[model samples]
Target: MLPTNSCSSPTMSSPELKKVTVSLPKRLDRSSERWHHYLTIDLIWYVLGYTLFHPWTSWILVLCLRAQYTKYHAPEMKIAMAWAMLMSAIGIFHIFSERLAFGSPREVDLSDEVIVITGGVDGLGGLLAETYGMRNANVAVLDTKRVDDEEAEEKGVLYYQCDVSDAKQVEAVAAEIVEDLGPPTILINNAGIAHTKSILDTTAEEVEQTFRTNTLSHFTTLRIFLPYMLREGRGTIVTVSSVLGHLGAANLSAYSASKAALLALHHSLRAELAQNPAAQEIKTILVTPGQMSTKMFVGVTTPSNFLAPVISPAEIAKSLIRMIEKGDSGELAVPLYAQYIQILGALPVGMQAIIRRWSGVDTAIAKAGLVKKDTSEKQ
Candidate 1:
């Protein structure tokens, strides 16, 4: 016979609730030797940006000088004011320049917008798809890899097995995506492949495959998805490229060349969009990440960790997601060095060669046994 009294059951107490703790992973303490060794030129530059190079901090010097009742004509006061004005002017100019270049941001409603991500089976693309899916956004992931139905459902993403490099497959996939998720308002053109052999060693077929996957895929996707965006009158296209595009590498000639084509394609897309009145709300984002710490470049070593650090796929994913959510057009070049890679081309040939050699660009692929014959999706 069961007891009828409610007192027989244990009552929840405040202390019991208070005793419950949500355990989290311990914070990383990077005060060790390896941590110090990991610090590099980019870290120093980042620190300076928030300190010495900060416009607000520069103005503080001018304010301090005035507080001391320093005359405007005085050398110290004049120098301080000049520095402050220069910094302030530069900062304001940058704001205006960005506004003028990109125009106003379009409204992004994830619930109403369809998101299409290519090469989303693994790596960076997978992260992006999963994130949007988790947010209850309509997400379609196109990849050659066959993901199980249960896994796709658990991740909240629609997976379509299609090779984006082939125009027929892309067209078919586009129809499927539209039918399933409505017209895609966000297109992340991330399909790519790399050929690591030297120019002389690379086969003709390998070069063709590299260009087809890395460069042609962009055109194919744009041709298929862009019409939908034009009809909708709003969208965002994100192009994933590489810093190697700006600096052609030795053993990575074909891979670098294919990426370089994306740089041009991005520019062309923007120019074409500018001419169209319907594309006023359409945004384009160019992602140029330097040596991402993915399996694509598993054993490759960066000459200087600090100067050209290996960026993680997660880092790139966050930036890409931010841009997409903001509904803005911009270029994202990570690891600091990628942003300044263009300058190397403007330098003297001998000087450029010296820098390349010093940076171990020519020897990096061969050194790490990175010449994998695998025909896999690129970064």
Candidate 2:
């Protein structure tokens, strides 16, 4: 192991950065030189938000109508004015609502922050850890997978081999991290695993293991690190959940249920922090992403690419880093569909059933060739 002082040194890139360079693999080529494929629901919504939904833009129409010799009470002039007033009211209400719910933003200085990311060896967690490391932040990664010492030095990431599911292991690592890189002020709880088994096919052990890794890890980490934040009076906790949590799937019952528990846990943590004066500056960010182009769900095809586009891990990382740096507490649900998934719960029971059926959420796992976990796959 390296000396404790070396833990806080300047960040470094992967070794391959110096010896070799490779072209980005062909994936979603934004530079495909096509135009029609750009037309999507998200793009339309963005355009409307700036041009039509903007209050200032709407008011400009009223000025134009008056310039054409329209009277104050003329139907077109009055309608335009009314629309502008309504949009302005909406904009003002949103501002107040956010302030009342989340309070003011906290000051963030990346140079002084120590970031601890669980499951940072791959997927979403890896992207985030790497990004912070690149920015020269003091970053510690906790994961089951082992990283070579040279690789860790190259990436400027301190890898701690510990399973977050074990409370004792987490506590031990917390002590080591404190001595190595000072207290961790930013915690990203993003470790997760999926077991694609039908409720009937899953065994007691499988269910327990799934919950331990996905759900209990949050509780364990909170108990271990919350005190550090309480004493320091500033921190950011990010919880990475899934869209499936809001809508439980058939074969993914265990996985979905575990993630669902986190949704409530996140709220509870926020409420507790709000009540504590010392914890006022501690921000909580919730990330509920849809089907991501990650290894965990590698082969699941999107039902509609336009409506529910598959997101890349890099996209999620960008949004997450933005939120953390801003020091704001909020919920981030990517893809338009995930943002509105909560509305399905408010619908009538009969309608909810019909929608779930139409979406084929229940059968997607089986159709995608998922199976129950065997003993050999338990890791």
Candidate 3:
């Protein structure tokens, strides 16, 4: 509504600007901060991790008690020591698990890698492309949304106008990217479109388009650009999926079904890369983010804001960049809840139904009046 309903001329004329729209609440100034604004499960968990769960911080509690000359057998001293030991054990186990699973981090020099990001003109993809551009990395963006030369130059990212769902267009753009930016070593398959309509009411064309863009596009980009990555000997592929992929919702049948395919694709892609000896240094990252505060889900609203807060595109972009640059393979689930959504499937059928209702996972679209008779793609 910020762009569509705004009376200001600047907001009305530039529709592309709508892609940057965020959730209602933003980072509030201290003077404007209210108690409710500071309260969220994420915030509480973050504070607890640093102060209570942190190994180093928990040890400080033991040190303070000892400095007071309290006996080791004292209840306070014993409690502190036990807590610190538990935290340390968990930390060591986490490190060991990561090493056992991913082996070692691959070296990455941004200047040497040619990066290609699909749907890089807007949302999380756009932020990542711009960040790499500023770092002087060779970056190429393929998107249906066209960016003029002036704007592209200003942002320092090469813009190629192409619909990623079409394999031919992607192949053509892949050739240009190789010529212009060298062999693409980093491919971010992020192009996606959502069609929110009931399964019964949705048409064949709409379903096919959604799958082509959201699911098959990953296959298209990987097939076209992955060879260069294999030849380069070192590369990173980031697949951006959705949390809804694990838990489908009403009126989002096509969108959820398409995203679900990405989960399978990411796993299959990782497995193939792992088996290839040449892909030892190649890394794959899967990002499954919860509801984002972006224009792509303009009308949608989460039923519980505290439990499932709307993560900003910038936050997810930062995590993606950190993993890609570090040259590590892993799965990223934003806003905490995304990481646990799979647990729902393991629960009893009645329990799963109850939890889904409580979480408002299925009814969010209909409640928000987001379902439409005419389906249109929104990126």
lDDT of each: 0.88, 0.89, 0.88
CA lDDT, candidate 3, residue 217: 88
Tell me the TM-score of each prediction against the true structure: 0.85, 0.86, 0.88
TM value for model 3: 0.88
Question: What lDDT score is found at residue 30 in candidate 1?
Answer: 40
lDDT of 1 at 283: 98
lDDT of 1 at 281: 94
TM-score winner between candidates 1 and 3: 3
For model 3, the stretches where C-alpha displacement exceeds 4 angstroms are 1-33, 374-379
Off by over 4 Å in 2: 1-38, 60-76, 373-379
Per-candidate RMSD, Å: 5.7, 10.8, 11.1
Candidate 1: tens digits of C-alpha lDDT, residues 112-150? 899999999888998899988899999999899999999
Worst 10 residues of 2 by lDDT: 8-17
Per-residue lDDT of 19-130 in model 3, one digit per residue for the tens? 5766655445345646786578988998999999999999999999999999999998999999999999999999899878777989999989999999999999999999
lDDT of 2: 0.89
Which candidate would rank higher by TM-score, 2 or 3?
3
